[model samples]
Target chain A: MSGVRKLVLLGTGLIGGSFALALKRARLVQHVVGVGRNATNLERALDLNVIDEASHDAAAAVAGADLVLLGTPVGQMGALMQQIAPVLAADCIVTDGGSTKQDVSALFRQHLPRHLSHCVPGHPIAGSDLSGAAAAQYGLFEGRRVVLTPFAETAQNALEQVQTLWQQCGARVYTMTPEQHDGIFAAVSHVPHLLAFAYMNAVLAKVDAQPCLDFAATGFRDFTRIAGSHPEMWRDIAVANREAILADLKACASQLQHVIALVEAGNTEGMEDYFATASRARVAWGQRHK
Target chain B: MSGVRKLVLLGTGLIGGSFALALKRARLVQHVVGVGRNATNLERALDLNVIDEASHDAAAAVAGADLVLLGTPVGQMGALMQQIAPVLAADCIVTDGGSTKQDVSALFRQHLPRHLSHCVPGHPIAGSDLSGAAAAQYGLFEGRRVVLTPFAETAQNALEQVQTLWQQCGARVYTMTPEQHDGIFAAVSHVPHLLAFAYMNAVLAKVDAQPCLDFAATGFRDFTRIAGSHPEMWRDIAVANREAILADLKACASQLQHVIALVEAGNTEGMEDYFATASRARVAWGQRHK
Candidate 1:
């Protein structure tokens, strides 16, 4: 109710660092504290003015904070919830910047006290291929969509406060169930990433057989650029959201099979028709959104 | 034996127009002539200074040019070659900016005069989702790779001249057989585009059921951006390089099957190992090249 005076951003990497920069630019909170496993990264966050102070102790960082934003990998959120549970204030709000929502929400429910209905799961759908505090920018969230998945028992006030924070940072907020969030992202975001990674892997596996790397063009670079993301981070994402990711993989494989069959069967007309429809739909979608 | 003085660029879209710009910036040609079906785009090319003049007549554009660059869709290259062959000078070096090399080379062999050993088939492995002369920039080819697939009968002096031209325009040139060129690109470029297009189509098909587009992020946008490229152009590429594209698709499908089996079997160790290997290899490859 005191307008979220003090904020602790746990795991001040790209997401958390960007959030801190946004908060500072908007002058939304009194103090911003950063917590991370690496002291060097924490120091870099402080040096870059992403936060007012840096601390390695999660408990100490969240001690008096009104908002604790968990910005760690999806697989690490559960253990972090337990570590910060005892130190979080009675009325403090807990939110996250993780990609998956189902697992994060479950972690909160299992670790945090039930009376602490301030847990609100949020994901700001904005990032670049670059990572860490050095890659953070002030307007990273501008004109981006941030989804908030609140449990049924979540405090109404806490949810509104979290929404306000995102809005002030220039993000359009959408509310959905955790399952729906994961499913949608699996189709649009997670699956696309996995596909890119898989594509690069397939090519690199044969790097010695052909001059694939030497002959790579701008198209290859752009398509596989994100494949260069943090391996540990992506591995966690793949495992944590295994079910939804597999569902997407199934859909993708079936689509690939259909195209392959059309080509193999010499169904030129059908193949052309398929590409035409996809091209038209995608072009229309891009024009509208861009 | 003299340096190229006049350059004629056919189908002055993104690649053609960009080539024109690069030639002008490098001062490699005295005049740049643009040929296209669309008068409006030709005018845009002239206004943007990508070309010194615009001509709708293919024969007139190639009449006295020292070099002619075909920049149309792969499907249209054959017709354009036939149209320009009669008027092209005996000494004029005709090359192409098409994606697939084997088919384009076949067209040149069929239509080009026997005296014109000057005809060399080429593909500049650079482009963006943007199209038309309006999207052209002078630095488009800087630091990009250009593949030149010369036939056995190709004049040695003419091949060297073409290589020098691309080098002057700030591109790294490499030589390969048309088959090797198509096969390598199918894995690194064509198949990736097909996968992106197919994946986007899959997501769009489910829009009615789930509205996944509403929550799409940068990852999805980047992955599917190529899907929005000219449908007719991609359609031509898919058909022209059918064999290599099919091979790449089969390989990708098998890789997806491995991932699918792991997920279905709930083999966490296998899944982790697969993703970790993919992520690590992709990251290393991306960093080295990108």
Candidate 2:
């Protein structure tokens, strides 16, 4: 397949900028345009060669572009889709690097109904605590997984083109329904962030919170590291993936209650069995993941 | 002050072996005898020079020893204390490397009533997933915190000797009552381990648990890292620190319920504030810790 003639990035932050940089390294896109509200970040992207041009107007930036990536937070993606709907080229393969799929899918249907055939919703599973154009790097997606959730009306060619582009950036691409993508991510990514935040809040609630934190060691550090995630970003995720998040949170709460009962009863044997199940599975996961 | 003439390590493992190694590095101990049920592990400790002598009998090993460190699990510490009580030297300083303190303090009182004045219980904050004599290292306690929970009857001279030994091993030492130590650790270390174990168990309860584990990334890895901890050891902790662990687990459960309510009601602003509170504190902690 031939390279993209022009590619526009809806948000010039880590995810979008990294995508542009990777595409540039792979020589899969001729010219890249980064659009964002942050002037300094856009300028930095240009200076760093993450994009060939920078634009403040999303609508103007997507005109005549063969590819557009919605890399903004889920809260901002609807308005972005609305902005580009009237200006996006007929054959442009529109996709996103959103964490959740269902909300982005609805946005696509609501704002870009006429362009549904060319629209694709995807999630690149390369999350980080860092952000901004400056945090972008060429190998961000290398050996990563990207899931594309295509609507029924989405053209096969458009879906394949998006998948191929991610593959060019050294990602392994998988296709799943939007619901599947949302459910899987809710279990793995979204729920863990929420749990970490909840655990942190619980720690903060202690009367001896400062001393508790002072004495916290490596175990506490690793367990609550994700609690330091971006607030508004995670908030949007909680709302967007509410149902799945709620289910997982409830499950975790139930698990915690069971643990309390075991400890309350001083049931060492039961606690051992409970912890052993988790420990075995976690050890197996580490072996596989590493 | 002066070095220990002879040090006896009961149930020699990672903690015991590392302590012996660090003391040797500081030239603060004349002789180290490692005692354990496992003959192979004892032999390994001797081979690694973590111990100058290997003994199968805790009682025999403590005979005429000036210092005896009960570096075993809380479960085994009671029996070892019983075994050594009859033979321990009059001025010998007995301490432990137990994670939970109150129970270890009780064990000392129950078995070594006459030796209470010379007993000082401590917890070294340098925890690792690795275990056994082979995991021992010279600098394991370097820059680490060692909390010593002394009995009211504990002699200042005995406490100072243990504190000075840890300081010589490159550790910062703090003193507290066993109750305070247990409460702080339950909030920080023990509860987090239980929570991670609960979270992992929750994931395992899912019908599609394998798929979820397959997609588990860095956040899941870090958040549930403690879930891979030794089950029997954690079970012992859960029993030993039951009251504190239960209190914190309940608090955590309540926090999760609040999060569930926020997401269920689509209260994005409320969720944002909740996440922001945790995110800010966690970020501040990372800055301080680094």
State residue B241's C-alpha deviation in candidate 1, in Å.
2.0
Best by lDDT: 2
Clashes of each: 0, 0
| Global CA lDDT computed for model 2 | 0.91
Q: Clashing residue pairs in candidate 2, if any?
A: none
State the C-alpha RMSD over the true interface residues for candidate 1, after superposing those residues.
2.0
* lDDT, candidate 2, B141-202, per-residue tens: 98889999998999999999999999988999999999999999999999889989998998
TM-score of chain A of each: 0.95, 0.97
Provide TM-scores for the models.
0.92, 0.95
**A1-290 per-residue lDDT for model 2 (tens digits):** 67898999999989999999998888889999999999999999999999999999999998999999999889999999988888888999899999999989999999999999999999999988778899999899998889899999999899889889899999999988888888888988998899899999999999999999998888999999999988988988988988998898888888988999889988888999999999999989999988
Worst 10 residues of 2 chain B by lDDT: B126-135
Clashing residue pairs in candidate 1 (N, C-alpha, C atoms within 3 angstroms): none
Q: Which segments of model 1 are wrong by more than 4 Å?
A: A1-3, A51-57, A207-210, B1-5, B46-57, B207-210
